[model samples]
Target: MSQSIFILLILIPLTFTQSVRGKDCVCDLKNSDPAFPEKKLKNVETSALQCTRTITSEKMTDLDRLMLGLQQRVKQVEENVIVLEKEDDRNLYGAVSLRIIELEIAEIQDLLNKLNRTTQNYHHLSVQPAAQLEVMKDKMAELEKFDNMQVIKTNRENERVKRDLEQCKEELNATTAAPPTVLPARCGLGRVVSVAGPRTYSLTVFTSYTYGAWGRDAQPAPGDENKYWLVVLSTSNVYGNFIRQYGTLSTLLLGIGPKDTYISSTNPTTNTIQGPNMVMYGNALYYNCYNTYSVCQFNMTTRAVSTVALPKDTGYSNKFPFAHLAATYAYTDMDFATDESGVYVIYATTSNFGNVIISKVETSNPPVLNQTWSTSLHKRTATNTFMVCGVLYATRYLDQETEEIFYSYDTKTKEERFDLKINIKKMQTNIQFLNYDPRDHLLYVYSDAYILTYELIFQ
Candidate 1:
């Protein structure tokens, strides 16, 4: 009976264990059981691990794309840096080349100044320096042939230098010493001793015209003394046919009371004005004729056009004109001026080697050339020329706002003076036209687009 009880206890224990296992199995099968929840959590963990792996792969792909883009950008930046470096090198080379050219020009100019000084000192020496001068000129010619433009520029400079050398040679070879200095014969209003105030300043009626001529009538009629005349070169700042007349100085200053007089009613014809340099005298407007080397006089009362052909080979159409280092006045080859004596035309001729040639014009039926005078002054070197008291005064550019009357040629005695230092203040850089009104002793200047008048001081 004890053995039987032991067997029952063992079996009961085994059956109890089996019952717990059965309950476990049943809980696992039921979805709402806690054991089932644990098993479901394990499956969810496995799924989450798989999803994380997939997301990691996608992040790696995006990282690879970003890395590739960064590499391309770095390459582009390197290329740009290389291009900039090459450009900088080229710029440096160009700057160095320009500097070298400038230095060469300066050296040539210095050599020219030295040559001028040597010629000036030859007066005290007994030996003729002709051979030395020739050698220097040869050197200058070689230097001038650097370029075509340089050749043109240096040719003008060399002309002046050659003239100076010729003068020196003449002085050296003279059998007799230079004559004693004789005081210049004083004519009407003596020499221009000084320049005074810019008494009147008037921007003209046409402000857009940058080049023009303006003044009162040098030889006025009875009732036209107070009338002021202006001619604006409207076409290319070079050609026009209209003359604008203002009644008085007040009217001119106010840009009011204008009367337009057309030389020709049609398009620019032979009688039309050609250049900026023009003047009014005795009810007639004198100007350069269109497309010709002649001076045209348009009579207001008669409405008649009279032209006188200039000397043959007279510089026209910008072959020669008033020039400075900066610019040249185009088509101003013929400049008309009126002095105490009479009317005159100042021009340059190739026959005269581009020297200033003055001719007296008689205001008869057909204005005829009366007397011609040649001066040693080079035409292109002077910026503008005007007559005062029968003396031709030439001005040169001193600065942007100053013009120096550095030269004079008296027609009475044929005397030339180069020591004049009278300076006139300027409103602008360029003076396109200049005229002296003998009636009022005033200088009428057309500069840029302004009409400026200055009172002259006589000694």
Candidate 2:
């Protein structure tokens, strides 16, 4: 009985403990602080991170090489383009000369095409091996670059240039008969008025050289044998000629020529005089020798010679009979003009007041002086100031001074005259410069054998 009671007590306690564990196994281990301890995973994580780093590094290296290759390719392309451009320019050396060569080539090609063969060279028309190769290369290269339309366009441009060259040559050849260096009417020109019309201009130049006389019964025609001729050449649009011959030294218009070379007479043309300052007026070839200043008109339409009055001197003749520029001088050198009034011929004469005298030819009495203005202001050269709305611009020379001064003459309310700050340095012996072209309001100054221009800011 005692053994049975003891077993029952022990067995009952064991059975109760096992039932609690079976009901909640995790809850039953409440006495333990942690269910599972933290683990150590260093090796696997470290290896994966290292692999990622290696992949990034390899990608960076590959990208650098790709960039380098791209830069080299671009540089190579640039160098090749530069070389090609230089070769093109080298091929075009003396490009203007190519025009002439092209003409010869075209003619040769025509002949060769007709005969189905090329020609052999002669002494005058010889071709070297190198020359032939160069021509062939140039022609083939240029032809390859052109389409059919481009070829036609190129041909047209060449033909136009050729035609222009011929016309320019013809005009240039005609000037051998006269001495006035023909300049193209361009931007740098000042207009000197001729009573012939509005578009006429004055030509100013210096020339020298002389002969004793024209006819048989002449005196020892005198002055400086040093040869200087100051002339008043007039420009006229009527005859398409530059000089109308307002006045000249005795020789140029009346010099001895081929048929009458027996010391008979020396005259230029037998023409007629038309209008004032003898602008655009041509003369018939004078049969006999006479004074150059005594002239008349030559008409292109009617083509006749009529007498015009011998102009009263616009003074300035103290040291007159300008010996040097006898047959070749421009009339505008001693004249004044404006768009409002026609023109004024000013001269410092021996008889008249040294004050300015004007020829008002545009009035009722065409030959009379409209008004006599006596502004006794002195000038450097014998040339006078042209007045526009009472403002004056005159060229003058001081006897002892080296430079020619341009005087801007104006008066205050009390008629007090003043000068301005405009001047040009002409200190040298003067080798033919300063021409006036009205087409452009400027002066054509030739200095140091180069053409320099000054524009007239007309006030």
Candidate 3:
């Protein structure tokens, strides 16, 4: 019976141990149930993945918007660069125009300064005139005190002196009335040895026209001896279509008695004057024709216009102007000069390599080019030129107040001289026009609106 009881206890303990192991196995299996905590963990992982995907998509969209804005900014910057470039080009052009205007202003200022200096000189002379007037009054008072008895004896002596003066004046007048000595046909006055005083000076009526030509007619008709002609470049200081004639020097200085002869009412026409280089001779005006390499002659009596074409390849229209270091006189490619011989046109030609070329112009109905002369001197080097006894004299800028006659070319002997040191005293900086008047043996200078006359002394 004791053995049976112990076997029972062992069986009970085995059954208990089996029950504990089974229960533990059930608890472990519950943790791995599909519909329980495992399913819940899978749903939570899906939710987190969806949230991450949404956030990534939104960030990519924001990056796309930022790239688009950067592209627009780049386009705007390119457009601004283009506008700036155009503005820079316009500014550069404006600067060039301003430079030209500045040069013109400087020229005007120089002219004003010259005028001021002349006024100051006149003021000094005027003071002397007043002082002289006072001295004359005092002399008159002293003369009045010495009258009465001295007066009768003085009158008798004066009458005797007057009779002797009258007899002497008659003899002197007879001698002075003798015929003048005739000169040679070509070089009538001979070589110019010296230039004498600027005997006369006057301002033009239109002083504002800074460039012009004015002088007495080189070959005037019988009734027009005292007549003077003027051509003021009324258009841009370059062109005019009229010639002004004054009866006398008094009328010219007074700006009265001007007879305007219009070559053409419409300027820049076929017969209009193109530049300041002009001459009135034989009742005709000779000048450069508008827009042509030719010379035009307008007869005052007949109102006829005649033109003669220059040589082939003749430079004109500012091609070969009177140039110097300081400035250039534009459209002065053709210059009309007259001397004892006749009218001549001074110009340069491309075929002659820009050297001075001269041609004689016949003063007939249709003026013809008679003879052509070429010189080695360059046209641009000369500031002005004139003809004297068939000799071409070229002047250069020496100083603001002086011009040097440094070169001459004689058509008679084909001689060239560069050593002539004859100097011209100038009242201004530039001589816009210069011509030698054979009638009075005078040099007519039109310089910055002042008309000056200098006598020529010939050997």
Candidate 4:
């Protein structure tokens, strides 16, 4: 009877507690509501708006802006090319055209770099919420396609411009005839003489000048070597002197005298600043400037001078105005020479396996580098170089009286001959510069302070 009473007491309290809890839960539920679905909807709408704004801002700030700039640059290049094609003077044309092409190339490279960055940005943004970024991805894909097409177009145009430059060079080269395979036997140094006058200016560093017939067979009356055409550098300007040859029978007179001197109105000051290496072809005087790494030309008729820079890293040592006997063999870096074909610049290059680089100067007024050849032999291996036809003959001195013409490079055939052992007999002296006069069939060599001419008597 006691166990039944205990069980009744437990059942009555459990029932009463259950009824009170139900009433409390209903009262709490009616007091407030969480509204989770409404909060979620508001957050999603805000995210979508943010994504749309970002897409619009990025489109304007990134790929679209770069593409617009690229288009403008390409258009400018095309217009410049058209203007260049119409230019009559080769000097101005080549300079302007090459500059335009270079600018275009740089622009294309910049655009490519920007595109690469844009591609990376696109990938970064791709991992964002798919629903919000889907449109952005599509837009980016289209921009990428457009940019690729433009890049390809610019590259093709760049190639076309390069081809045009080559065409211009070919046209210039065609203006002159090819040189002979073998030169005459009496085509070397000859007589030496001196000038008679009062020295007002110094020829100490007067390195650049032309010593050749102005026109075809333009020689002074047989023995009238006293009065001749002269273009030499002075302290003030590059003066043209028509003076008399004087001094004793043993020593040859050189340098410009005080009489009959006139400054080259166009190129006078340009060449005077630095000692240049010069050559004469027909009516034009070609030279390589020391201060500037450019080959310059002076038109004898119009008195106009133009210049074009040499290829980079060609080891052009513009030191000491006069020749240095001590460093003559060591720093024998650059020399300007002319053959029957045209003018050429010979120098040792640190690049291209330390090769001797020979570049042909086209007939353009500024002189363009038409064809180039790299010799396996080092340039300093020889004391001097003279181009015969298109072949380069390197001379190495054995002693005061002996020089071995042991190296020959044929630019046309691309052949190197090391077995050639032609011996040249001369006094032991540093030969500063040498030129083969096609008109008189003699080699003019300048050594020490004397100008000597020799006859090239080949066996």
Best by TM-score: 3
- Tens digits of per-residue lDDT for model 2 on 57-76? 33343334334333433443
Cα lDDT tens digits for candidate 3, 176-265: 888556543355567876675455566787879889989988888998897888888888888898888887654565565489988889
- Number of the top candidate by lDDT? 3
When summed lDDT is taken over every stretch of 10 residues in candidate 3, the lowest stretch is 26-35
TM-score of each: 0.59, 0.30, 0.60, 0.44
lDDT of 4 at 431: 51
lDDT of each: 0.74, 0.32, 0.76, 0.51
Clashes of 4: 19
Model 3 ranges with Cα > 4 A deviation = 1-188
Kindly list the per-residue Cα lDDT of model 1 for residues 47-94, writing each as its tens digit: 555545544433343334334333433443344334334443436445
Residues 185-283, candidate 4: write the lDDT tens digits.
Answer: 123322121111110111222344322111111222445332323333333332332222322111112222323322243443454213324566655
Candidate 3, lDDT over the whole model: 0.76
Candidate RMSDs in order? 38.6, 31.5, 44.6, 27.4
As for candidate 3, its clashing pairs are none
Error of 4 at 447 (Å): 1.2
Q: For all candidates, what are the clash counts?
A: 0, 44, 0, 19
Q: What's the lDDT for residue 99 in model 2?
A: 42
TM-score (C-alpha) between model 1 and the true structure: 0.59
